[model samples]
Target chain A: MKNFYKVGLMLTVSALLAGCGNLTNSSLSSHSNGTKTSKVTTTGTSKSGQYSTLLQGGEYHTSAITGLNSESDSDNASNPKSFEAGLLEISKKEFSPDKYFFQEGKMISASQAQKWLGRKSKNNPEGLNPEDNGSTDADKRNPIYLQQLLEQDFYTQNDKNYDLSGMTIGLSMNDVDYYTKEKYGAKFETKISDEQRLSEGREMANEIVNRLRRRSNLKNITITVGLYKQNVNDSLVGGTFFNYGVSSPGQKKVTNWKNISQQNQVLPVVNDEKPINSNDSEDFSNFKNHIQSYFSNLSGVTAQTHYQDGKLKGMAINITTQFYGVAQIDSFTQFVQDAAGKYLPQQPTIEIKIQTVQDPEAILVKDYNTKQYSSHVFASY
Target chain B: MKNFYKVGLMLTVSALLAGCGNLTNSSLSSHSNGTKTSKVTTTGTSKSGQYSTLLQGGEYHTSAITGLNSESDSDNASNPKSFEAGLLEISKKEFSPDKYFFQEGKMISASQAQKWLGRKSKNNPEGLNPEDNGSTDADKRNPIYLQQLLEQDFYTQNDKNYDLSGMTIGLSMNDVDYYTKEKYGAKFETKISDEQRLSEGREMANEIVNRLRRRSNLKNITITVGLYKQNVNDSLVGGTFFNYGVSSPGQKKVTNWKNISQQNQVLPVVNDEKPINSNDSEDFSNFKNHIQSYFSNLSGVTAQTHYQDGKLKGMAINITTQFYGVAQIDSFTQFVQDAAGKYLPQQPTIEIKIQTVQDPEAILVKDYNTKQYSSHVFASY
Candidate 1:
């Protein structure tokens, strides 16, 4: 009872101190007392006049947390570590305790994915060595390699951690993409997804997190995984949330995970093992030949087709006229669509490069192709 | 020992069955075997060819972990949830055992943050009556309110529980933004940041998450807090990781926490309160008037100033003359720079919106403004 009184007294004193501070704040609030105040935003049921209009046209300044990760300085004693990076660092360091709980045995396996995402060799599909064979450094920057480590390998926070019963292991799939024309010095005419893309993304993360729980060495360290469909435009468009720790999560999850990796971008060189015009296949060369023979020669128009994995997917057609009209565009699209229907038999669905064009960027045509059947979307980026 | 042998024998048989699947996969691998394949992507140091391509622009779909969180089919077979409204209905329906970890206090005291995010004559800056005052349903969508409940507000995951210790609580701040001249049917000529905007964003999320850990009710429930700088063009860009358990583990550390709430678009409200112009003070209205009198008057050049805290920070001057030489542009910029120096006293530093106009988006002249020193920037958005 005596201890309670003492604690209650301290609380009273603190409340009084806080009251003094509030008084100062109230005085500051007077700064807005003389303005032509009208609520700027409304709430669900009532008009909230709580927000005072500070600016209307010219630039307005608002308080923000800056250099949040800047090293802590003791010189400014008024600024507490609890306010800056220290707080984040602390929360990040030990957010998950020595032991946690999660469902077991539910995640996607790269070994299974190795059948496609990894090595072409079936035995090495999951890429037995995720370490980039050519790179001398560890595969820290390799998403696939790091994901392999995250899925197949486990680390425990406790040193003497041998018993691994009743603990939950987490699995995550982090994949990212990036685009920078300025860095590339050339326009890479690539396309991406819409809303459905994001919905599917969470599902992928769910798979990894679910599976990691089943692994044997799961302890202490909490794992988070996801994917990034990152792209670099006039500004960096994707890839956010970075925690300052001893590790680079980006090096693990999604860092340039979406790049059409230079190796994969190369035209397959004809080899002794695989003849170009073999019985069961039609390759890029054949597609290009077909495009040249079928479409480019159509009406004094030159066309370029962008494809991957030996199928015709994207094309840029020059219709001879720069300031083209809707009718001309339709006729052009119709012509191309007809050609695709005939020559590009493998790609049942196709679309034009809406951006790889000059301005006036008029949608002169109603995109006759849309009125027709939709083409299958191929690029996951 | 006999049971172990039986189980081991069953596992061995299953392993062989899996191998048969691999044998079939190897036959499919022959497809790439026919092509000259080389990995395209490089590791940090040297380029590597670790990837294998399967999509031939047609539909060569690879398998992925699906049916994750899917409901069990048999109604009486221990699991009878058949995939909810597409969301995973928790299997641990009431997972935690009884009164779990959490103090009695520490949630948003309806009295404290009744204003908006906090109190201001009874409105929470984050908004009060988060019950969606207009709607009478549960708060499954309101992340902030849910976070508050997860933090201070206590509820039993399952009844028959009374133990509260050694648990940590977490907070999340999920803010997103969008950019779609294509979707909104109109283009709001709002200028945002190149990098600093991203820096401030993480800080906001950090603040929320950090504060949550300090709350009394912070235990057990792990909160993953974050913000997103989202834009909708061809793809969805932000806000990914989410987990519901004990302890908040925010991911992607800080991505985009503030991009202006989409809800605020509803009103162009002007508020009423003591117009704190202080009779002789520099206030929001004065700044607006100053901008109107100064930059809006410049002939042949339409200018816009983006400010924060009522201080002008950015001015985008669009001159009709393009492909026009730099010298003439310098004269134009000088005229405006001089006006800014004289009129917008609060804003010492200003920048060019490098993307607002056509080519020669390049800085035509060294900003006389830069030689003149700079000021703090304030765009809370």
Candidate 2:
């Protein structure tokens, strides 16, 4: 019989699961005028259990349930994960898994979604994007504010059938509207100012909410909206959600909005004199140095950190190593795991991807508040 | 505001959903001893709602639930998806979606799994791999049979709790055992004959079933097993499951075996004198030519088709083109959708991916028994 590769899986498992809780408050903080404003929401953890059956039975659908293929349209690879994951995280605040089960959005048909994503016109009053200014010059721009619209429906178990009780909409606004003078022509970008982008996004949200409310079925359902700003096409990291608002049943508009200061910043800031979060940048630099110090053959170590308000929320680190052996990767993963524990903030979730020039060699993950990290090495035969 | 992109989504939606049913009989055919043998079993389609609440609530875990991270270890990119998806398909026959809810396997701990994936020895009898026969010659080799083990648990709602009702195990057996003599040494592969591989796989399955039965908690639970042969290291396509069996409650071993003749063959078969199914090969070739003829600048067109017994089961087509505009991609997708309808087999599921030099431009999917295909063109602007 084949012999097993001895690794401390049990030790890692117990450590990985330590400090676990069912539904825990995940707080996001932001500093405004030097005064910190934090939003506390209970996000369901892995231990809390993910989905519930539609009392009648079938699979729970997420947007693009087959895969997150809808978001795949973006050139930025990380945008899909950030958009989908961020929306789910935001949804948990309004629709708790304890009470509501998840389902693919049935309210917005694909055609309707397409219409809403297009430029405004008399024929298509439902459009949520700005009408084209008919400008060819990249500098004098008619920026398309909205890129994609994502819908998620939440259902509550009612006796025998699950009824739609709530809904969440994610509007992916473009930071830079991209276009070309003609088909296959040189691409051009119309850079949008943050002030204009946010204001335009809020207006679109209001219009969308009002239009959606017109439907008899959705008129009395609680609707939650998350306004997301997609990263520029060339950015390595993904975009962030800046604002969110919830309209109560029967409400026509989102009167009150909550400011969300979430950001995805590349670690080891290239040219910026002052990093957004000095402590996180410093911690990441130390972590990188510590791992690279141990293994001089390491090619490079880079990270994308997610921050809420000013606090580090998550870190995705990529470690490129020259070593290719399974045993060597396993040992290196352990070393990196230890270094991460010592140098990185304990409150944020962390993931390390060990890659060669061709493919991934191993991966290590640590959830927020967890004491231990779990690592897996691919068996390359 | 922007107007929607109209692409007949409603017609496609209705057409795409034709002949849909929940937990329907999915038959698998295999010709044995010149006699056609077919096994009829129920499988959960998208309509058969997937998960159930674990009374207490949380996410239903799958093996490598975070993502199929465990399978990502394989050098063959498609192996992970084939192994995970194929096993789930086989499991659906025994575990109906309406009755059983899915969860990650808890019975086999990660550490136990590592032990079982190892070579059998006096100190570690739990090992499931063959013992090392020290030999420098590749001709005289001790081949490793088991590459990986995957577990899936099915739960039935009982009163207020969901209890494990059945379990399925997927054994990823190697067709070619890959190894290196020393750390970072040049890689070597020992090809195992089909007859030897299948027999050894059966014996290993028996041992695993017996060992699992020894656990009191698992003693009475029904267990199903599927034996998969992993494709060689550099394969473009993944592996296939050849045999499967089920052990009833209180049964110690799988006494009756069923044959599965599923395969993943690259279209325009590279070197075989005759393709596995002549009709499928012809259909794929025609489809490729039809699409390319419409768009002359198309760089390349390739496909991966899956077959059950001798009939085509599914097709994944990749179409590479130089076109970059959203409108052009969208129109081209429509043309491909039409060509696929006219040229491909109607019974099998079909997916066509349209890609540019930089990234994926569009995607078209037509599930089995669906008349109209659903298409999405990425908004690249």
Best model per TM-score: 2
Q: Give the TM-score of chain A in candidate 1.
A: 0.24
> For candidate 2, lDDT tens digit of each residue in B1-381?
001100111110111111121112222232223322222111122233333322111112234321222211247767765776677778878987677755546577677777778888888788877766788466796777888888877776444224467988888888877777877787887788889878888888888889888876678788999999888767778899999999888888886779999878777878754677888899889878855644567898888888888777788777888755332344466556656766777788777777777655656666677656655443311
Question: TM-score per candidate, in order?
Answer: 0.19, 0.47
Candidate 1 residue B310 Cα shift, in angstroms, is: 6.7
Model 1 agreement with the true structure over B138-200: per-residue lDDT tens digits: 222221221111122222312222212222222222222111234434322223343433444
Scored by lDDT, model 1 comes in at 0.24
Model 1 chain A lowest lDDT segment of ten: A5-14
Candidate 2 root-mean-square deviation in Å:
24.0
Model 2: per-residue lDDT, tens digit, A113-225? 77788777888777777676777787775678887777777776444234567888888888877777887777777788888888988888888889988877688889999
Task: Name the fnat for model 1.
Answer: 0.00
Question: Against the correct fold, how does model 2 do in TM-score?
Answer: 0.47
Residue-pair clashes, model 2: 33
Recovered native contacts, candidate 2: 0.00
Each model's fnat?
0.00, 0.00
